[model samples]
Target: MLTIVNDFLWGQILIVALVGAGLLFTIGSGGVQFRYFGRMFSVLRRGFHHEQGHISSFQALVVSVAGRVGSGNIAGVAVAITLGGPGAVFWMWVIGLMGMATSFFECSLAQLFKRYQPDGTYRGGPAYYLTHGIGQRGLAIIYSVLLLVTFGLGFNAVQSYVVATSLQASFGVATWVTGLVMVLGLAVVIFGGIRRIAVVSELIVPLMALMYLCAALLVIGMNITAVPAVLGHIVQSAFGLEQAVGGGLGVVIMQGVKRGLFSNEAGLGSAPNVAAVAHVPHPVNQGIVQAFSVFIDTIIMCTCTAVIILLSDVYQPGASDVDGVVLTQTAMAGHLGSWGAGFVSVALVLFAFSSIMYNYYLGDNSLSFFSDENPLVANIFRVLVLALVFWGSLQDLSTVFGFAELTMGLLAVVNLFGLVWMYRIGVRLLRDYDGQLRSGKETPRLRTEDWTDLDIDERAWRD
Candidate 1:
């Protein structure tokens, strides 16, 4: 079943979907992630002000970051290294880099096109952006359903699995116990809604990420002298130019791309859902916040994971018994002993725990959109999500992760296609933002009725 789902998920269909969307976005956006990378911090400053949106720009970005930066950076990194060797890390880099433009463009579209409420709130994402941006409501419905299943149910469930697996591996906890505890915990947060999720993420994401990176980088820095050679090995192995054992060029490239996409979720259209809710004056403003998200998730966090693996020299042949987080722990243990393994156990729990809340809120908001704010439908989605928490925690997580990956890969291909159509819109928005900056404008407004008709997120303007 696992192989079959993976075959379908990573099949030629998804391969085309994943790569085609990113490639198209890369060309269409003029490589915006890198072009705008230096400006992200400044743009992010907009998040500091209170706004009229659902959440602060920083809060929304962090909420999405909480979701995107989870097990993928940790266990997912180990999986990529285990299967693809060091060369795979190179492919992951390509995805994170190229994927950011996709993320920025999508968030820009979502922001520019979202629907605002009379109560000074907003709602948008693939459904709103695809429908409004592409002028196709039908396709938007299709996209929403896919997202509902994928990110809402599928990814959240996978998060539970990572928690269960990590606990089982490191602490000998039963999967049932893991599932029940998580279900109860997730239920509490999901019931609290996006604001609560944002708050929790604001607290947990920074601390967990800081702790994880500090631990990983300590190991990487210790092996700093071996970094160059390890990078060489990764490059040579990626193309199978150096001849890896029991795998070919396909395995090498796919592992990195798969894990990397899972890491930052730039092109996957998931983060933009949260990005749509962030309170920013301009669409591109949120885009910059998202651009930094990709860099942080992959370049900083996942790179740390890759560095530790490389430095530990664990990509050696026939190393299949240890994979995922265990592989990462082994690498850490080699450098830091048992204490390092303890850190992995704690980090995975926190990372996966935070992701559960992120996914739950995303799913809830998505359902609210679909139901046109019908309370009944909203309640059902929440109930179903809580139910899945137990199902996911106890059951094998790879099942849900596999399905979610397929859904995300499909959405990226479909959504990126639509994003290409928004190029003219992006140019106009960017020009508008630049004009404001040039005018030495302390405060900028979205001059278009198009912006007002959609969601009005002006929290950045609040005191």
Candidate 2:
């Protein structure tokens, strides 16, 4: 049943919605993702500066990136190749490109409709936007529940499963031991709230990414002669022009889209939950920053893993027994010897650990929509999340991934529906930001007074 639902969602409904909506948003926004490509860095650089006690835009970005650049980059990429072939990497690239625009709109809307919390913080996401932007309280509730289930429970389980399996494959560590360590570490950080998560992500995300990229670069350097052949094969396999490990073109596309969305989370609506937490002068600023994060995750981080695996001799085109984190681990070991496997295991721990933190925040934020920020309710939710993390370690890969994919598809559908319906408002925010830039302002600021017709939180945006 889970596989059937996932097949329908990934093979039919979601691929169209994700690609079509991304194209629409890209065209509708005048290719804002492209136009602001360089500007994203500038916005991110400025994002480092924030008012005291507020979440800086850069912090918010790393939190979203932490959520994105996890097991999906390493284990998920391996799964794509195992099932979809090298061609799936091409589709992953395609989705990453289109997803940038989709991320921008969703995140901008999140920032726009965000609520001002009494604790001098912000709270918002698709749930807040649905109710506050379109007067749909019931839909908001549904989105909140799905968010809680998808990120809070389903996706976090997937992360735990990946890390546990990777560690067991590499170091002979017991999966149960890994689960307990992860649960204990996660409990300490999550209880500290979003700020601590942000700080930890800020430190770990950059350093870990750099180390992983350097490792990939070393592999690419060693296999410099095969670089052209590997690149050509990925493109050829994507079109079924070459016989490869995965099935036909359909399987290639499906795997790519599924794993790609899983990796970067462009249109999945997960990033917006964190995007809404940033203290930015204009909503579009954070939107641009978030868009850049998708690029970092899929284009940079995921591609590194793909190159490492494909460039390795251990990766046979159609191997059956080797898959998931083990494939990645084996491929790395084949390159850098035994230590290579250890490196991947350590990297997975850091990546998935940060993701657990990011995922916890999303679930906690979603609970706020229903519980009115009740402390007891929040603690209970944390306990449930911790339980899932441990439970995930004992489960098989397929079961955990299938459940996560099903819930993620449902959540994306709801969020995409809201994005399509609220298209014009997204455009207006873009134009307003552009208008300010054209008027010679170095930083575009949101003037809440100008959007009187919209249900924006005035106190949240007040200078």
Clash pairs (backbone) in predicted model 1: 50-459, 51-458, 51-459, 52-459, 86-234, 87-234, 114-455
- Each candidate's TM vs. the true structure? 0.90, 0.96
| Clash count, one per candidate | 7, 0
TM-score of 1: 0.90
Please identify model 1 stretches exceeding 4 Å from their true place.
1-11, 239-241, 245-250, 397-399, 438-444, 449-463
Write model 1 residue lDDT over 1-463, tens digit each, in one string: 7567667666566566666767766676667776767778776776866554368888877888888888888888888877776778889988888778777778877887767765566778877877777677787777777888887889877777778878888889998899898878777777766777887788899999999889977886788888888778878887788755567888888888878877887766788788877777777888878878888898889988888877875557547754678788888888898888878888888888888787777677678776777767887888898788788777766656666776776776666666767667776676677678789985455666544543444442232
lDDT agreement of model 2 with the native: 0.90
Name the regions of candidate 2 deviating beyond 4 angstroms.
397-400
Task: Report lDDT (CA) for all predictions.
Answer: 0.76, 0.90
Q: Clashes in candidate 1: how many? A: 7
The prediction achieving the highest lDDT against the true structure is 2
